[model samples]
Target: MHSLSAKDLTLGYGETVIIDGLDIEIPKGEITVLIGGNGCGKSTLLRSLARLLKPKSGNVLLNGEEIAKMKTKEIAKKLAILPQSPVTPEGLTVYELVKQGRHPHRSIMKQWTKEDEDAVQQALESTNILHLQDRAVDSLSGGQRQRAWIALTLAQQTDIILLDEPTTYLDMTHQIEILDLLFDLNEQKGHTVVMVLHDLNLASRYAHHMVAVKDKKIYAQGTPEDIITCELVHDVFQMKCNISCDPIFGTPVCVPHGKGRSVGANQKKRAAI
Candidate 1:
């Protein structure tokens, strides 16, 4: 029962309490995607779980113990977190950046070990950035830079990984590639992945557990099949949408009601031209 959970989390900045008394039990060895409208406290919650943000009240627990009470290195060994935007040091190569993830495992007296080298190499390979290892991170394309950052997180080799919007600036193909890579990590290594995703369609396809946050609390949570519906979308996102199943993965797809491409009887008649 390896559980990383937030119990009674009153998360916020200073006195501006955003999340008031929330509890979420992260399913171990599964992909959990947190979805919410902007400023709904989803990313804040993830940071709280990683001990990066202190809760206004209550506790974030790792395996039944309070994460806030644990040593930083101990917490790092169990969980690795990638923020929405990370600042890369100037002139630092990808390998140099990835190697930093191994610092938690190194003692004051111990230098870089064979294990560290192997971990960095493996992480680079896993993220498909092995060829770019020697290149400076700042010089890479947006997608490449993102993959480099992901490789750094993977290199840490933690059982639990938290990511905040991993596909922010990437194109569609790279977004899918990133998600697919994460899916493989969850499946092959059984790493507990909890991330904040903006796209409902991708979240539905990839997440084993979907937690929809709203108004500083969870609006709904369950399998994508159960949680993603017309009512939930309207309630959480405030958008009228048609709920349909994805043809490829049979996952829930939300076709939001708005002025976009025409897809009615007129669309069919126009296509017949």
Candidate 2:
């Protein structure tokens, strides 16, 4: 059974609908990437799945139960969300931030225990931020700060994680690092990861399942090889492109046709010969 799904979901703000009557099921224990152009509702859809956004017309189901009816702490125990460019509280250390993830597991009757400490430690270790645990979150570099935030999510110890553009504003190297970390969490820990990503090529490489959003609906969705094509790119992104294979991963790669330096056709033919 799908751990997360949306049924006839309609989401918007002040009558400006972003997503209308959409339905989607996130495959359990796999990496699902939502891709689309700006304002295409990718983030909106993800937020609704995490119950961060209230839908106008339908329900989000978590573990076959309606999510809207679940208690906040219960939902927190099952799913974790890392929103886009989250703000770090001033003077908060990495360890302190990560420890906050354990809040859902704690209460007036249940104080901190060994389990919470171990979970936080494991999260820092998995994200390779153990060495920076004592450092202030705001003092770390871009990559390190991102890792710290991710460690907070990891410490939640949920089976499912949702992130909105987790790699935004980072350099290409950091972007790959963040994606690779999420990939490891999925492969090694069997966590269900759903995120909105802007880079088509990186998303194709890491995503076990890809959902292309366009025109307030899913344009296509499947493995990259099955659904990512020149036609889909044009229809969804309004761009012309050639579909090629990644030499390393053999996943579909989009090569856009646009103004840039070009080898002449005769030179291309001669080089081919």
Clashing residue pairs in all predictions, respectively, total 0, 0
Cα RMSD, each candidate:
2.0, 2.9
What lDDT is obtained when candidate 1 is compared to the true structure? 0.92
Candidate 2 error regions (>4 Å): 263-273
RMSD of 2: 2.9
Task: Flag clash pairs in model 1.
Answer: none
- TM-score for each predicted model, relative to the true structure: 0.95, 0.95
lDDT of each: 0.92, 0.94
Report the CA-based lDDT of candidate 2 relative to the real structure.
0.94
Model 1 lDDT per residue over 1-273, tens place:
268998889988877988999999999999999999999999999999999998889999998999988999988888999999899999999999999999789888998889999999999999899999999999999889998998988888899999999999889998998899999999988989999999999999999999999988888899999989899999999999999999999999999998866569777998899
Candidate 1 at 36: error in angstroms? 0.9
Give Cα distance to truth, residue 246, candidate 1, Å: 0.4
